[model samples]
Target: MQEYPNYQDIVLVGGGHTHAIVLQMWAMNPLPGARLTLVSPQVQTAYSGMLPGLVAGHYRLDETHIDLVRLCRAAGARFVQACAHHIDPLKRRVSLLGRPDLEYDILSLDVGATPARDLPGSELAIPIKPIGHFHRYWLQLQKRVQKTRAPMKLGVVGGGAGGCELAMAMAHALEEQVYSGRVQIHLIHAGDKVPEGYPLLARRLVARELEKLGVSLHRHWPVAAITEQGVRSASGATLALDQVLLCTNACAPPWLAAAGLALDTQGFVLVDEQLRAQGCDNVFAAGDVASFAAHPLPKAGVYAVRQGPVLFHNLRAALTGSAPKSFRPQKHFLSLLSCGDKRAVAVRNGVAAVGGALWRWKNHIDRGFMRRFSELPIAMDETPAKRPREIVAARGGVSLSAMRCNGCGAKVGAEVLHRALEKLPAQQSAYLLRGAGDDAAVMELPQGKLLVQSSDQLRAPVGDPWLFGRLAALHALSDLFAMHARPVTAQALVTLPLATAEITQRDLQQLLAGAVYELNRHQCALSGGHTAEGAEMQLGLTVNGLADPDQLLEKSGARAGDCLILSKPLGIGTILAAEGMGEAQGRWLQKAVEAMLQSNAAAADLFAQHGARALTDITGFGLLGHLLEMLDGGEQLGAALIAEQLPLIPGAAQCVERGWLSSLQPQNAAAYAYVDNPQEWQKLPQWELLADPQTCGGLLAAVPAEYAENCLQALRQAGCTQAAIIGVVTGAERPLAPVHLLRKADWRELIAREAETVQS
Candidate 1:
């Protein structure tokens, strides 16, 4: 079976190669009755095979990294971008940083070795093990160098393969990027040879290449401490340096030392040949984080790549109650080492070769490996259709869709609702006189305040019910927030897929619990609503709010010359649509999720305080449609938008460039019919984005030109990082029409021509 309402949980703790391969394989062949979840702190995992190429500027960021979010989407797994802080074997729980703990029936660890070893003064220098952090540091370093454009000196503490490659790459790139500034690089090695464990010939070739690239190499110089002045060597010699990086030996993450798993001398998990933890039946580990008890091997990605098939086989065996297979270390494997330029050294079985041809071959091999991740795509699905074996047996082997009941019989049991509500934290409310137990909730409005109500629904965008519930709840409450109303109470309307009793109970518990978590934050009480078993999982909310009539904002009172301000970035719809098709990168989805989770309440308050003339929330209608609504169908008013001024989500531009748009995008584009020469404007990259629908998007407001700058600052102070002034309104001429998109150059040219006409 390819799908099931999971009866067992399988959690993977890292986004390394082993787990990535396992996910792709799972998509091809899935194990029934098991749910897959990946907990990783990063959405993108760097491929070590192409790290040298990336440093050399031969490959782009996307080429050298795997998108974990897309991989999880392809595998039908729930992805949680968080670090695992601790593991409790007895309780079968994994504690996470900044979120709730996860319970697992089976757990796999592939969190690669950490480079933050017990080196003295290591904090003074950047450690290069966590690739994500290193990549960020690398980007910042480039910007700093470009900005200052001054003579600089850089040092690498350990002359391992990583150190040598980066030193050479930096020297070569600086010479090209900042020709005016002289840059010197130094490679200091504690060992006699660069990359101590490698062959002598390979070491000699790497040294020759480093010399050709003008990278100075120092052998047998172990740094004792890093000081403000420079790196102090064991021989009492100090080398002055502007920046230092540590490519030191790798060790297990510090948190693993306290975990209850058996570990080796270096704190790595001890596992059998089958990749299963020693003396543990339900836990397994792979990659550099695990040490095979049968034999010792150097930390390499190839070993993890080799372990993928065995790990997959053993995991399925464990879940299905069958025999498992063991993994064997390859006796001889080829090694490719790249120089800063387009040249590499290949070594195998006492023979070594070096040249640009070797580099091309290495590039081909690396890209081939990465293509496996990019090529896998999945079909969009609303929900898992299959049920556990027990459910099938109980229902006479009929599918859940065929066996589902109708009307009253389909309603969730009252006992289940009572049980789910009991776990919720208390929320005291003065507005709600009665809730839950009666046929209807009775509420009272505050004295002299106007009542505001809005309702919204969304199908499951993610497999994680808890997260989906929170997003859905926020999305529903956005309407009231846009109108400057204070949320007071909410009624949930939930539709859950038919499943076993236990599965249904778990779903409701997680879903409602997440919804209440947000409601409690907003001081809104969850009064009650309805739930029914349906074909798919969905969430809706009917929110009631309170607002002073004089202070309320609306979408119809816009005057000419008003400045248009958007509180949040665009691209939520594009990323979600691409993610559903398994075509989006994990980093893109990360930004989309962050934008969706933001609340527009603060922005609304700022808009009202700054004298906003018109207000609307950018939701399912997209930016253009919502803006048109704010203009009251643009009957007597017109607007001009600066394309370059629009704030966008990180990966949104790329998604639109790739034509990944939501299903509602075409309908949203209908709003552009009100504009002049809309087809000509279609060539702009921001076109599809303006038509991209959003859920829980930002507040779009028309404010006075004088308040625009002050309002923007206020929004930023309140944590609206992407807020910006997008455009202005112009209502004098019918020729101006309802809308017009002006690129920066065109806008400047138009202003020049208008100034000339005024002078005439």
Candidate 2:
């Protein structure tokens, strides 16, 4: 492992082919004092070279896509799963759609292009760029064609290699499903012939292949508009089609034009031969999004791949103040086009050849390129190169020759922490008598009000210190919300890894800033706590709130006939655990983080308005454990949890099925003994998720049966999109069982019984 102090930040805007290559290279030979950050909208980026094969059912989704999340982890880079909204070149910051603006000393953009959608009724057609979205739509189309026996008409726009290849691929896929005779396929192009830019032989071969596949070729035709019935060409010629796919001229993202960067006529960022953004020394651009001003090249994946090594070299040069080498693209390159079968056509310069052997060669090349990123070199354990003794002494007084401690030995020095604390802003409150300096913080209580307290701590699940702190504070505050109390103050308990005094102080500031930001959002004052060094990062918050005696909610007030409402989705525990092992996608973890950061204050108020009888925040003990606490050996009151109705995070069920669970899951599963009628529900993959411990989870409340729907609606309107009425409380007739697991088949019966009980 490599470590650097006070490193410079390098932010990569997208996980394109070039950037993906750069990340892998950096992992092998990392810059000594540079930190890398990758910002991408999707966790998996598709390889364009293999996309035609994927459409033809020759490849699986996972086989053609690179997992950016796992790749970043292997590269020791921070992965921000968010869309890049804009760039501030003057300020050196990249603004994301739903997160904070990322500050960078160096910035790079490798976001690929999308099809031109400015034509009339273009939104009605599917664009092939932004490959992730296209792949999902393609899957749905495949399922639709397979299920229905009705005839379908499909049109492909554009005469280039992509458009031609896709038309043939779609035909091949439909034929495989035995719908070839019923489905009509059209390849529409503005040019006079298919494969317009290819050699004469390649063009003739592609034309012959299209004819063999029974695909109609509409030459010298440009689409004027797309309607529900069909496509209307510029010459008043109309073609009836059920669906249209546009593989027309690729265009730069709209955000690039809005960012005020120097762009070419087509709106792509202009870059020099060295791949540096024109007129911006600290910025670089590559892939389909960049236009090489000196020697222009076609917007192809091959050019992007060729530019990777140069971009990587130049980026390092910019960071270390070295001269960058120029990049010169070859005048001509070989192009291999898959014929939607086991054969391919290879064209280079003015020569062309066709054979199954060519297809195999292309397959080997594409797979080998993908393997560079997918199968990264295993990291080896090697001793650090010896540094001067004086340099080691200046850093922390530890000898460079000595091995670092594993546990408490990795903690920071007490004197170092004390010095860091002096630089922090003073946090004083009317409720706090003595500030954070003493052994403990002292606080005063308001007259005639009850004190509500809750404490929570956890090891950092994310690499960002600020994000971890914010999550920690939110986790603690969730308890106050469940109790229907107003948060007044909080004390932080932070543990940081051993590092230099400068690095320690910097991390401390970021951690506290995040915690304070969340605390101040609720008008809660920070009353200081304790900080110490540790083997790993951990953050804990002890929150104090004020509650009115008459309005306070408790776990003991749950009634037999109440409706059980969960304010958020479950399965976050499984998601986090999967992420730790690099088995989770970036998008799933992103959703989990957003859920954890949401404050439960509004949910609490809504629960109270809906006449909730009992409330508790789900935490480390899992939903079953917390619900069991409410049951508490009551003989006359029991609960029924509907398995299908439970709200779950997007990929949680899949993770559970894969046996990815939190370390504390076994302890929480012990409460299964309290369940009376498990039935076949216990065999479900989601069954284990009930015992999965959550961090900063949602509130579980019991409300009147009649108001359940209304409460759920209000919660959804208030942005708790996953909120659902999972089950209902039942009157216990059998004393031996207090909990019941209801499957989908038992839903109607349970509802009928509840209705009769209410009527009685």
Candidate of highest TM-score: 1
lDDT of 1 by residue, 583-629 (tens): 88887788888888888878899999999988999999999988877
* C-alpha local distance difference test of each model: 0.82, 0.81
lDDT of 2 by residue, 337-456 (tens): 988876788999888887789999999998998888867642222122333333344335543234556555555556666655554444546677865667677778889899999998
Give the Å error, residue 90, model 2: 3.8
Consecutive 10-residue window with the lowest summed lDDT within model 1: 745-754
